[model samples]
Target chain A: MKKTTQTPPSSGASKESQMLAMVNRRFFLRSAGIAATTGAFILGACKDHDLDPDMTVDLGSGDIGILNYAYALEQLEAAYYTQVIATPYAGMSAMEMSILTDIRDHEIIHREFFKAALGSSAIPGLEVNFSSVNFNDRASVLGVAKVFEDTGVSAYNGAGKLIADAGYLLLAGKIVSVEARHAAIIRDLLNPNSADFAGDDITDSNGLDLAKSPDMVLPAVAPFITTMISGNNLPK
Target chain B: MNIFKIIDEIQKVDGDAVDRLEYATRRSFLTKFSRNLSAAAVPAVMATIVNKAYAQSPAAIDVLNFALTLEYLEDEFYKMGNAASGLIPSMYQTVFRQIGKHEDQHVKFLAGALGAQAVAKPTFDFSAGGAFPNPFSNFDTFVFLSHAFEDTGVRAYKGQAGNLINDPALLEYALQIHSVEARHAAKARAILSEIRGNADIKPWITLNEGSPAQVYAGDDNTVQGGVDINGIAGKSKEAITEAFDEPLTKDEVLAIASLFIV
Candidate 1:
């Protein structure tokens, strides 16, 4: 779960901005070089974003659109877990700490994987608003974690049909189950020795977990981020 | 409300529409059966069209039947385990009961969806010809098998997502059930870890480490989408493997399931 890549094999062996460049690369570019070209675009958007916070970031069309949709969610998850680990809640057990730490790495890896796969088509790093989350309190942090993990599973489940490529469908399948596992572990932590791991609320009497459409999933996660994500171009 | 009237509307759009319906309806074509049918018959006739429209395609039917076979195994396995006195420890009975309930529902749901096409539940030898001599009698052995079944279910459902692609509704249902199995599997792994006092057996599969090693084949792979992602974002190799669950093809899954099938 330890996440530190002092140097990417591909990115330049440049000066002090390596740290800044790494973060920028994840949020803004496919590689360190692409950052220069997308740089102006990012700055203009930043000023426009400052003026109009409601301008939507459109998830493009076709498989790229679906990939971007997924990329966006991974960004949110990676950011959240990164924050959770950076500022651990009070009285966090060794077991809980380890579990959350693994989840954080998985999410970041997921985020980076999509970014790498999407290449230039990937959406920029989303601005998160975690004012609603209380990182110091275990209950509050876990509550948000539960919601995020469960929502992630539902989003992937629902988005399967929108994926036109068989490879992409299988890839989405690869990621969702891991999210479900993360969700189960977090739920177990909240209520030990209970069936809340596959609780009745997220799953139905038919025993199927929730499969929600992008429209349904987008709004649920909207509160967690300050940036607007317009899923209008996403495949139905 | 009126079959002929609806056909007339359709004919206005395309002169040969009724002929195509007569041919396209396949098993439910009504014109061949009753040429003098009245409007009252529209209700009955239209119902057949609606039903056939939702009927599973050949691909989906195969996947659903395969899924049904797996669900039947899980439902029966858990039922027997939960019913066995003093088999599941008092502390973990509730967890087993809940899992057993979900498997039961999965069986009924899948069988109901398949209806006449549903495959009969195979006679399962939980003992696997003495491979698992005391599946129900031994609590630890039972937990181990439980983990295997749940994990297999997740992989099995996932492998068939592409087959169900043409049928969106079926694909969605498969996904919904797939993740539920994952939830059950994670809990089972955690319980097994507790039973054996092994922290190495984490909720997520750590580099294909688990009993019934075949199920975890291809799991140690850090490559995804033809790219070596071991060091992506600087995460450890274990995290890379744990981040994604690999799918087992239908043939692969059935071979594993056949161990218990008589």
Candidate 2:
């Protein structure tokens, strides 16, 4: 059966209720005129900010760990894409420019999505040091692009099973699909003759896909990533 | 196309009129009419419903062992593959070396998770019953084995996802490694297919745009046309789309392990 419609909240009703709740006899007895002013002042402080401190930097655990894990990758991807867009490679094709731009947007969306979704559990905006990368050179950009995309795809594939919530799994799948597309495009850029773009990276003899735990992936990603990011709080 | 269709259907379910109706249009007459329409439609939809249960099997003792076994297989394959001096492209030598280390790490990690009390790691044959008797003899064997090994690892990881969900920590770590293995698999396929100018890396067992074991024969590029995954009720896809990998039963995985295990 279809569910009933949810009731919508009236604008500022909740705020008005709180303001009145502060007007008890204790307020009149405490400091008369100043109590009313103090109550209003306290209400003003309760307003929420765009950047919540509780969510800006997560310490890792359960869903927070996963969010932080995703947050770190988003930071890396966003930085790379930002560089790509800021300085397109020499002789960059329109298609390449357009696709890379779209990829950049997607990465930003993903980064922001994690931020919004995690709310109070999101990690702080990470500091990604990709200073060694030369964005103007096609080969250099593509090489790093290949590594980053491949790494992203691997990261997703390895983390899928750890999620118990199907909702989260579905979200991860959506992101992974996009990441795979990015990997394919990057691989194609590296070598048009290379069938690398349209291939499987982690399969086995009986035609099974390989998965690894974060404990394994972090050490590998650690060398490339200069900063030490913790995901210890991700659900065990 | 499938995704578009699904979204389209969802939009239809939400009804265009409902979206078009602004908050200001919540008058008595329109609200009553809409409410009646929804009430009428609900019963019709409810009457034909069949409650299908997608009952999932919990992680079996055997599936874990199966995963450990696959890990062993990949661990051995990479060790041997890396040992081949001229086999790897000079440009990709560093890539392969790093991949080898990653695979070793995966094996060790799984070994640790499984613990000493966990099932023993399977000993791989590395030979597919003389199908490719001398894999080390030539580049073709290397290519074939590499492709096969990587493909198998991808599926194996996918197959075990359900079983490991109960162990959140282990599952999380396993997923991290799974992604690395996928990269390795893709890399291996790219190298092999590029050498032959085939340009196609979709395995014979994968179908339905690489969903693996879900499409028709002519639809995919598999050499075998199509092969049903035992215990799993579907045909392998063209390249094994990253969508859903078939879950393997404990018995099914153990049976495969027995073939290679000493």
Candidate 2, A69-159: lDDT as tens digits: 8767866776678778888889899757856765665565455445435444445555456677777888988888877776676677666
lDDT of 1 by residue, A100-121 (tens): 9899888887887887776555
Candidate No. with top DockQ: 1
Q: Poorest 10 consecutive residues of model 1 chain A by lDDT?
A: A1-10
Question: Which residue pairs overlap in candidate 1's backbone?
Answer: none
lDDT of 2: 0.49
DockQ of all candidate complexes? 0.37, 0.04
- Across B164-242, the per-residue lDDT of candidate 2 in tens digits comes to 5544433444455454455565566555656777634432223333322221112222211012212111212322222
**Cα-based TM-score, every candidate:** 0.81, 0.46
- Which regions of candidate 1 deviate over 4 angstroms? A1-54, B1-56
Measured over the true interface residues after superposition, the C-alpha RMSD of each candidate is: 6.4, 18.4
Q: Give candidate 2 misplaced runs (Cα > 4 Å).
A: A1-88, A91-164, A170-236, B1-64, B83-95, B121-123, B202-262
